[model samples]
Target: MSKDFLEHKAFVELFDLHYGNLVGFVYGYVRDEEVAKDIVHDTFLTFWNNRKRLDLSYSAKSYLFTLAQNYALNYLRHLRVVEVNEREVSQLLEAASDELAEYDERYARVEEKLAQLPDKQREVFLKCVVEEKKYQEVADELDVSINTIKKHMSRALKFLRDELQGESILLFILSNR
Candidate 1:
């Protein structure tokens, strides 16, 4: 071993002397026994790996404690980041759930109002508006004149607008067609 580095026996002795104290020190910051122990072990691993860089001016025990403290602080910071992300994800999910429920309720209301229309009016509305068919196409499909198709479509729109007044979702649905 280099003069700057501790031998295996000396390092092992150092670990045995300070391991319990380092764990206790980290536990004071982290408040978890397993996490504190893990941090202490990692600190020792880092110390062993960088043994050649050891500065004799500083005590080995002090260096080990400082490394353990840093590890504990990093773990705590990671936990806080995870908590914030979890909260944001939960809020987004809740908002989406609320939006879905509102959409379902509005759609049910539109379906209820559609059921109140006469069969021909409902059929014309579905074909021309919901199915995006042209008036001439709807007329040909229904074996009716285009003028009759136009009248049915007009009456259906007027009735739905009047019944679904003050409903922005219905307005958007109809206006988009």
Candidate 2:
């Protein structure tokens, strides 16, 4: 969008026209009225901030929905990860000292894989996976978009998976003995 298109009048018109629908779309995923509103608000804020670089030819409506959908999905993914980690932590706490050492070794091996990634990917992977920070928080800290963070994360995961594929079978064989 051009600077003129992002002026208050145009921006307000855009918001007034679609804000409620966007919120409703988000509500379908989150199932909370307030959270849906907040997500829509954040989406508009991002749109306003990135107005200059936004492609004017495309349907802003589609872009808005896509943005909200990604946010909703990220929220769901984070919740799932949190619940799984809680369960895993409970089990690990009940595990014996030998299991703790084994966990540490496995973690070290994962860390080595992370180190092989590019610097930005490694940092993002660690901050997001190890430090348990949200993608938005990491994006704000790194001065990038959530989309960029997601891209880096996707690439990182793919690289790690391919790199670990053979190791996984080898480790299974060794550990079973």
Candidate 3:
């Protein structure tokens, strides 16, 4: 199957057949209705993109469900990580004696942490998170798709969290300044 093949009636037929049940199944893992739908849609898009490489031996339903499962698991994992990070950060902030010193230290730590990212990830992280550039603006400036910029930002954040784990000051400077 090719991209052109995905345009064929059979693909829409397959989508109609599988999408609802798959979304319901995905909702079980993802909990959030909107995110579950998005995951299913993204899985279908992936299937369309890799339609040429997709194995005929396996059921498309199974393939899509598997993709949804993987996507949901990853989403859950990232959500868990973010929750933990935020919780720890709140605790740390509460522990701080002076807000000014804490913010100043966090500003310096963010710089040091960002320096640890790869060039592209670093650039994406700084532009999007630090400079607070819009994703579209960063994508335009970097000459990449918004999706590519988002991927770089995700990787950069995960890398920063892993490297800066257990630090008193959060890796990111959460203040508007």
By TM-score, who's the top model here?
1
Better lDDT candidate (2, 3) = 2
Q: Could you tell me the C-alpha RMSD of candidate 3 in Å? A: 23.9
Model 3: lDDT of residue 168? 26
lDDT of 1 by residue, 111-154 (tens): 89889989999999888877888999999999999999999988
For each candidate in turn, the TM-score is 0.88, 0.49, 0.52
Model 3 has an lDDT value of 0.83
- Model 2's TM-score against the true structure: 0.49
Residue 137 error for model 3, in Å?
A: 57
The lDDT-based order of candidates, best leading, equals 1, 2, 3
Estimate the lDDT of model 1.
0.86
Q: For residues 56-98, what per-residue lDDT tens digits would candidate 3 score against the true structure? A: 6998888988998999999999999999999999988777847
lDDT of 1 at 132: 84
Report the Cα lDDT for residue 14, model 2.
86
Off by over 4 Å in 3: 1-7, 97-177
Once fitted onto the true fold, the runs of candidate 2 whose alpha carbons sit more than 4 angstroms away are 1-6, 94-177
